[model samples]
Target: MHDAATPSRSQPITAGVLTALVGFTSSFAVVLAGLTAVGASPAQAASGLLVLCVAQALGMLWMSRRHRIPLSLAWSTPGAALLAGTGVPDGGWPAAVGAFVVVGLLILLTALWPHLGDLIAMIPAPIAQAMLAGVLLSLCLAPVRAVVDDPWVIAPVILTWLALVRFAPRLAVPAAFVVALVVIVIWTAGHGGPTGDWLPRIEGTVPAFEVGALIGIALPLYVVTMASQNVPGVAVMASYGYQVPWRETMTVTGLGTVAGAFAGGHAVNLAAITAAISAGPDAGPDPKRRWIAAETAAWSYLVLAVASVALTTLAVSGPPGVVETVAGLALLGTLGASLSAAVSATEGREAAVVTFVVAASGVSVAGIGAAFWALVAGLVTAAVLRRR
Candidate 1:
C-alpha cells in the first residue's frame, strides 16, 4: 500500500552538496576534539573522522530507502564534546565500538516493540524542546566567546553575518564563512609562522578495540549520544510534521553508530537542528522530493567516509579559527530559532526554561551531562505541576 510514486532524483547533486557542506561546517571541530580526547594521534583521528562521515552517509541512505523518507544521519556533536571533555582516554575505541553495536541492537529491537516507541512518544513536547535548546546553547556561545578572545578576528565576520542574516537570510551562514576565511587568510599571510600552515594534513591509523576502553568510553558515549542527540533528533522530526516510524529511524541510527564505530567513527544519530532544513518546505512540496534529499545525503556521506582519513587530515591542518568561526556562524540561526520555539511552546515555558538552565549548567552526574538531567528535571516539573 505504499505510494507508488518514486522520489525525484533531479536534485540529488544539490542535496549531496548541501549535506556535505553542512557536515563540514558544523561537525569538524567536535569530531577533532573527540578523536584527540581519546588520545588519537593527528593521523589516527583523521582516519576515525573519515569512518564517521562514511557511517553517517550510509545510515541515511539505508533509512531513506527503507522508509521512503528523507532521514539524514550525523555524528553526535554533543557526544563528541562529552568524550573530549570527560577524556575518553587511550585504547577505548573498541569499547566504544561495542557500545555502538549494543545501542544499534537495542534500536532494532525497539522497532519490533510498539510499546517502546509509544513510551518515547509519551514524552511531552515542551520538555523535549527544552532539552534540545539547552544542549545547543553552549555551541551557540562558542562564537560569542571567540569574539572576546579575538574581536579583530571574529568581529567583522559576526557583523557581516548579522547584516546578511537580517537582509538576506539565505546567504547568511555561507557568506559569513567566506568573508571570515578571506580575512583570516589575508591576516595570516601578513603574519607568518604557524599561520603559514593553515590547512589540515593527511594521515591514517588502524583501529584497535579493547574491553577496558569500552567500559570506560562506550557506555558514557552511548548515554550522551542517545539522551542529548537522538532524543532531540527524533523530536525535531516530529516537530516538523514528519510522521515517519520512530522505531525504524531508531534502528537506522543504531546501525549507523555501530558501523561508524567499527570504521573508527564515533556515535552517529539523527540530526535534530539541521534536520529542519531538508524536512521543511525548502526541500520540495512533494514529500517524495524531500526524501530524495535524505537519500542524496546518505550517498554523499558514504563517499566522505571512504575518504575520511584524507578529509580529517586536511581539516586538522587547516586554520582552526576559520573552521570554528564558520561552524559557529552557520549554527547561529538554528540556535536562535530553537530557543524561540522552545520558549513559545504552550504550557511548557517554565519547564523549557528549567531544561535550558540545567542543560546549559554544564553539570555532570555519574558521567551523564546536563542535557540528560535537564530533560529529567523538566519532565518531573511538568508532571508535578500538571497535577496541580
Candidate 2:
C-alpha cells in the first residue's frame, strides 16, 4: 500500500492549481452545453455549473486525503447532458437532486458489496476507452465549429494555443483559455455588449420529493453517471497505476453529487479525461505526494461551490465562441489518445467500434442515455460474435 510520505516532494500548490483549473474548465463546458440544451437561461445554468465545480473540487481533496490516493471528482458530462435532455422535463432540478442523493447512497452501499465493483471491472478496457472517445468527440468538434462561425474570434486563439502547446507545453492549456477570454472580453466591450450581467447570479430552488420524478429523472441519471462517467474515470486512474478502492471512490463521488444537488449542481462523478492530468506523470512522479495536490483541488472546489452562482454566470455569459474553442483545444490531446487506445486493444476493436457508434449516435430509450446503451450494444455484439 502507498503512503503519503512516498510523495513528500510533490508540492500541493502547483498540482492543486493545475488539477482545479483543468477540472473546472473541462467539466464546465459540458455543464453549459447541458443547460443550453435544456433551455435553461444562461445565468441559471452558469450558476448551477459553478456549484458543481466547487463540489467536485472539494470532494477530490477530501477523498484524496482520506484514501491517500490522487482521486478527483467531477460532474458527469454525459449524465449532465442526459439530465438536460430528459430530467428537467420530468421534475426539474428537484428531481435531479433527489436522483443524485439516491445514487450517492447506492455508491456507498457498493463498498459493502464488492461484487458491484467486480462487475464494473469485467468491462473490457478497449470498449470502455471507445465509449470515452465517443463522448469526447463532440467536445473536440465544438472549437472547430466555433472557429467557422467566428474565425476572427477563434482562429487566432486556436493558432496561438497550438503554437504554445508545441513549444511551451506547460502553459498551453490554461494560457490558451485565458488569452481567448481576454480577446473575447475586449471584442464584447468594443461592440457595447452587455457587461452588467456578465457574472452568474444565484437563485436557489428547494428539492421536492416525488416518486414519478425519481423514476423519470433519478434512475436514468444514476445509470448514465455510473456507466459512462464513473466507469471510464476508474479506467483512466487505473491506466495511470493508481490502485484506489473503487467502492470508496464511487461513494465519495456519490456524496459529492448529493452535496452539489442541494446547491443546484447536477450529477457529479469521477473524471476520465481531466483525471489523466493529475494521475499521470504530470501530477508528479511520486504517487504519494500527488494526494496533497488532490487535497488542494478539493478544497478549491468547495470554495468555488460556495461561490458557484457568480463564477458560473461569468463562464456562461462570456464570449461563447472563445470559450468553446478553448475547451475543445484543451481536450484535443486526451481525445486523440483515447481514440487510439480504444481501437488498438486486442480482441476489442469490434466491441470498441460498437460502443463508439452508439455513444456518438446520441440515442436514448426509456430515459436511459446513450452511454449505457453503447456498453450494452458492444457487450452484446461481442458475445454474439465470439462463437463465429
- In terms of lDDT, model 1 sits at 0.63
TM-score of 1: 0.69
lDDT of 1 by residue, 1-388 (tens): 1343322334444655576666654566556766675566666576667767776777777777777776767787766654554344344544444544665555555567756545655766556556655655665666777888788877887888889878986667757756765665566566562211223333433444554444445544555566556777777777767766677677676666666555456777777656766666656656666777787777766666555554444444444455556556665555566578778866778878887788767676664445556767888888777887
Candidate 2: deviation at residue 51, Å? 2.7
| Structural similarity to truth (TM-score) of each candidate | 0.69, 0.76
The segments of candidate 1 whose C-alpha lies over 4 angstroms from its true place after superposition are 1-12, 30-45, 63-71, 76-102, 167-171, 177-249, 270-296, 306-311, 314-323, 345-348
Model 2 TM-score is 0.76
Model 2 residue 178 CA deviation in Å = 1.0
lDDT of 1 at 331: 52
Count of clashes in candidate 1: 10
The sequence of per-residue lDDT tens digits that candidate 2 reaches over residues 230-310 is 777889889977876776676667676776666566677887766776677767767766777677777777666555554
Model 1, 307: alpha-carbon shift in Å?
Answer: 5.9
